[model samples]
Target: MTGSELKKLLEDSPEECHKLLMKEYGRYVYAIVYNKLRCCGSREDVEECFSDIFAEIFIDFEYREAYKGDIKNYIGTVSKHKAIDFCRRLNTVKGRSVYTEEEDIRQLASDFNVDERVDSSELRRILLDKIDELGEPDSTILIQKFYYDMSSNEIAKNVSMTASSVRSRCSRAMEKLRVKLAAAGITR
Candidate 1:
């Protein structure tokens, strides 16, 4: 459905809008939650996160201002953020260290000076498109390794590859991504 139609439904009949929104975005929301929490959380946790996302968007009425842009994109952004938040809370409740050494290293690596000429959102879109172009296991490995902060062994278990193989493929994928990003003029 179009953004205008959805917005009108939201304003006119919130209950029906809520149902339609869930029907449309449920899988997308679940995917984001699963990717973020698969390593540390159960299926129930993902479901809870998905429900929380819908509750935050619909019941809290945050989507009122989101009608200007693509509703799916807005929902995806909210899903990602909510899933990350759920992961953090899960770690805290489990008494695990939320911040790890790998996370520190990743943060240090990402602390490069921002280019004033490139808008952050635009750069992010470019990078995401580039990553998608990488295809299959490479894209999945990079996301799991960097974004989700999964170790090679953990990733290996999930992907059904050896730990050493996961590391090797991850290294290769990083090089490929670096080249792709450089070609796109998104240098670090």
Candidate 2:
């Protein structure tokens, strides 16, 4: 049915709208949710995400107001977002493989005797301290983005920022780290 028809049905009889919504979009929403969660979630997780997507469609104002286009687009958008949320929650709650790309910044070669050469361990400590100084979400964003190789969207979910904002923060954080590392005799 058209979004206008659905909106009218929602106003006149919400129960019927709910029924019709389930009848029409249930499988479509489930498919989107399933595609997102298939690798990390159980059957129960998929069902819960499916239910949440419909619940969000029912309450979210944007979904209700935007009847100018096909309602299928609205339903699909809602499904995609809800599934992403589920993916973040399920993947985070489970034990993830702690694989981090080694930070590849190389320390400047020292001219001193072998016995007095700069210790790699000390440089690593300085690097970690600099990252800690960047503070909460910035540090977290950097670790998620570079260390864990997460996309900006995935990192934004964890940090509670928009994807673009996350990307910008990541850029700023990297620049700051580059300067700090340079001061510490580490260069990219």
Candidate achieving the largest lDDT: 1
lDDT of 1 by residue, 1-188 (tens): 76678778888888898889887777557668888999889878988888899889885554455475467877889899999999999998999984469878889778865674368768866876787688877777777787667799988987899999989988888888899999988789
Clashes per candidate (backbone, < 3 Å): 0, 0
Clashes of 1: 0
- Runs in model 1 with CA error above 4 Å? 60-63, 98-188
Estimate TM-scores for all models: 0.52, 0.50
Clashing pairs in 1: none
List candidate 2 segments past 4 Å from native: 61-63, 97-188
Backbone clash pairs for candidate 2 read none
Q: Mind sharing the TM-score for model 1?
A: 0.52
Assess each prediction's global lDDT (C-alpha) against the native: 0.80, 0.79
